[model samples]
Target chain A: MNKFKTTESFENHISKEKRSAKAKAFFINFLLSFYLFFSLFFSSSYLIYEKNILPSFFYFILLAFSFIFSLLWTSKNSSLGSMAIYKTNKFLKNRKELQSEFNLFSFSGIFISLVLILTILLGSILVDINLYLLFSSQGLSGAKRIFSALFQPNWNIISQVLSSMVDTIFIAFLATFIAIPIAFFFSFFAARNLMKNSLLGNSVYTVIRFISNFTRSVEPLVWAVIFSVWVGVGPFAGMLALAIHSVSSLIKLYSEQIESVGQGPLEAIESTGAHPVLVVWYAVVPQIILPYLSFTIYRWDINIRMATVIGLVGGGGIGTLLVQYQGLAQWNEVGTIVIVIASVVWLMDYLSAKLREAIY
Target chain B: MSKTILEIKNLEKFYENGVHALKSVSFDVKQGEFLAVIGLSGSGKSTMLRCINGLVPSSSGEINFQGQDIISLKSKELRLARKSIGMIFQHFNLISRKSVLVNVLSGSLAKVSLFNGIFAKFSKKETDKAMSNLELVGLKDKAYIRADELSGGQQQRVAIARALMQDPEILLADEPVASLDPATSHSVMDHLAYINKELNKTVVCNLHFLSLVRKYATRVIALKDGKLVFEGSPLDIDEAWFKRIYGEQAREVGIE
Candidate 1:
């Protein structure tokens, strides 16, 4: 009788634990539903006020239906409730899985936030003056006008596009070429394992990082305009601007690549009585070189496109031609220039992909 | 008896995060002697080996190698000191992208100048020497192959060859076969033993398995919680001694 009672009580205890878990899950989900409803209400109100646009009452109706649907779903599917709780409870049960999930979530969140911020900033600027206003001020209108002007094959338009493209390409190339050596020095200081003294290493890294941020923050177009006033219009001004930006970007990428290298090879090199610089050259550089090359090529391709845009401000290359075409109301020519630029960018993309495959 | 080639006097290291990695450890290694350090994780065995090569700077201690205090040596002097001591890691850390030949040649970086090193302007003699080292590790055929192309055992052989290229007087191996299979572990240990016997190089190795240490180590040192608890011959280390060194708690945890 005593043994039977013990068995029965053990079974009862397990069932009680299960019941409490279910209850906890249900309560948590109920809170989530309430929070969502509140958030929906406030978001809808804010959207209406900000945009001066009312979403149809149907959206509110849909929200109410969804909430009701979720409640019913949770009641029937305790398994689903368990899964939802599992996300939060995961760290206690399986640490590796939790860490990986957290990493992915945070990385994606940061990336999405950056994209949203950039889009909003750019949209606000573009919406005010508008691309149409800038184009219409020169008296070019309709797709027909653009087509005719392009079909007529004006040499002036062709020349302007060619120059801008050349200027852009040259700027990217020159900037990258000049920045590579400098970035190498900065990356050495940035690498955690390379430097023994953390304070000195961190200070060096911070200073270089600050310099890079400052350089990259000032857009190439702005830099070109500033340089144009200082050195007058040409490819030289554009090159300087791109070079400054390249230094900052390359340093960041290179340093990160350096940091990610397996410490094993470095430890091996250090053990062999190799100097710090030698260790870096052997262990660190070998690991990072392929990735660095790929990043550089990609950056160069981007700079070429930017160089063309910056040329409108007289920094030199195809942008100068683009500006001239717009001033002359030659929209068709502008379209042709855009096509050529797109083709070049596409070519770079294909080549870089192939090269990365070969190296990697 | 051979002269004492290396001496450690009250060597201590405390990490910036306040982990007492090594606590006032002292030992001497004679020329051409084979010493195996046996310990579980966080035992300060690896830390002690790193201090000899000046890889991990000692917080308060003196490492005297060839009658010179290695701890006080700065930049170039440190590099010069490092050249005489070669190290092998458990993971066989080779530059995966580079060919085996280039990996081996990396060991000679200390002797070569910065300009030659960067551009890989290694002399024909240096190249031949690297090839010979590869031959010693029996990977001469895999010279042109990338380091990643080889198996774990093969990669370890390549690493050994890379260290040999340094023509080091002392070889420090930190759990060099921890990543390999049992059969491969024996082979790698055999190679290390052969190197010690043939080249008359002083070898201090950190080992996980006691069997391997018994087979190779002339002198065994055991560490527990950053403290050296046992320093004696292999024959002297019986099961009871091991129990004392590891403790009943560690035995229950299955540390062996």
Candidate 2:
């Protein structure tokens, strides 16, 4: 009788533990769903629909509904509360393990959908987004005038724009060229694998990493403004700005490539009794050369695009000419500059891709 | 009678992550003998080989190579000492993108001046020697091909050729045939045997298979849990000794 009673109690104990677990889940989910929908509904009604206080009658109904929904959501002790209901189709059911945690379609899904829809409504009101504006008479007329003028670019200003475009390309080229060697030199010191051997190496690694991250976080246009103020505004200022930013960006790319190189070849070369410098040249260089070249070309592509933006901040290039015509409302002249920039960028993209492919 | 070329005493390696990889390991390697070291994975076979060459620094021990204590040597002295010790790995460790000739020539990097090494300007003598090593490994025709284009067995042969560029007195092979098929394993083993006999270079090899050890090794040593458990001829390892080393539940698996 005692043995039979023990078995009965063990089964009861398991079910009891399962019930408490389900109840805990239900309570937590009830709080979360209530808070999410409440805030979403309250904010939309108050801000978008211009209601001062939350609608008490509607809120009470929602609270009662959410309580019942959460209870059903946590039934069977499953997770995610029907969040992945759409994934329960025949194709997905065939791959049962790929299905998400929530398996059943329940009332909780309705609450979540309501929260998502109301959140979008609140977001649109906050941003003042009105799709009707696009078709409004005022907006349509302005867009038509600008787009029509843009289609018929001023051919007379083509020569002037071409000179500025050359300046823009030169600025990008010089910036990328100047940054290459500097970034290359710094990359060895920046690599964690190479610099992790000694305390001094680790310190150098940290400092170099910190400096590069700090520089890269600031945009090139901001640097262009700072350089323009420092150097009295020219393509030289733009080149310097791009060069500085490129050095930091390229160092990060190069060092990451260096870090990912296989350690087996390194140990093999070291076993040959080579000097550390020779070891790097033989083992590390061969591994990283192709990736390094690929990354540098990628950087150059970015620098060319950035050079145009920098020019708008009084760092001399085609963007300077673009802003000048734009300020004067000469949309046709602006259109010509934009076409030249677009064609050059497209050409650069094609050339770089071909070069990378050839090297690979 | 052969003389002792290398002697290791009380070798211990404690990695920073607190893995006591090797514990008081000691052994001797005789001149011109094909010595095989066998163990399960993580049993310190690789670590013991690396310690002999000072590739992985030992926590405490004496590694007496020739007459010198290798553990006591400074960095520059160690590099100089490493020239006399050539090492190969299971993966072949060749620079995959480089030509086979360049990969072999790189084995002589220790002898080349930095400026020449930087420009990849190998001396004619070095190039000829590299070619001869390639010829020795029977890959002379494939010298211009990229290292990755070759098959696994061929890549290992190239690695052997690269190691030969050092012309060292001793060759340490860490699981040389671990990554190879049975047919390829024997071929690579045959080359190693030839090198041991013709070149008269002392070889210390780590092996996973007892059959290969029995076939190629003059003597065999076994490590269990980072300690030397058995040291004798391959014929001496009976079934009882195998169970003692590999555990009672183990069954001997043969490659051939």
DockQ in order: 0.26, 0.28
Please give, for residues A142-220, the per-residue lDDT of candidate 1 as tens digits: 6557777666654555665666676677777887889888876787776555553556766776777778778878898
Give every prediction's interface RMSD. 16.4, 17.3
- Model 2's number of clashes is 0
For model 2, the TM-score of its B chain against the native B chain is 0.98
Model 1 whole-model lDDT (C-alpha atoms): 0.75
Q: How does model 1 score by TM-score?
A: 0.71
What lDDT tens digits, residue by residue, belong to model 1 across residues B1-256? Answer: 5899988887777653335678777888888889999877888988888888877777777899977898777757888888888889889999888999999998888888788988988999889999988888888999999999999998998898889888888999989999998888888888899899998888999988777877889998888887778898978988787787767665522112
Task: Identify the runs in model 1 with alpha carbons over 4 angstroms from their true place.
Answer: A1-160, A182-186, A189-192, A196-206, A327-333, B1-3, B119-132, B244-256
Q: Which stretches of candidate 2 lie over 4 Å from their true place?
A: A1-141, B67-69
The local lDDT score (0 to 100) that residue B177 gets in candidate 2 is 94
Which ten contiguous residues of candidate 1 chain A have the minimum total lDDT?
A90-99
Model 2, B1-256: lDDT tens digits are 4999999998877654335678788889999999999888988899999989988887777999868898888878988889999999999999998999999998999998999988999999999999999999999999999999999899999999999999998999999999999999998999999999999999999999999999999999999988999999999999999998888998889878
Q: What 10-residue stretch in candidate 2 chain B is worst by lDDT?
A: B12-21
RMSD of each: 12.0, 10.4
Interface RMSD of 1: 16.4
Q: Over the stretch A131-235, how does candidate 2's per-residue lDDT look in tens digits?
A: 899789999999999998888899999999999999999999999999999999999999988888767889999999999999999999999999999997999
In candidate 2, what fraction of native interface contacts survive?
A: 0.62
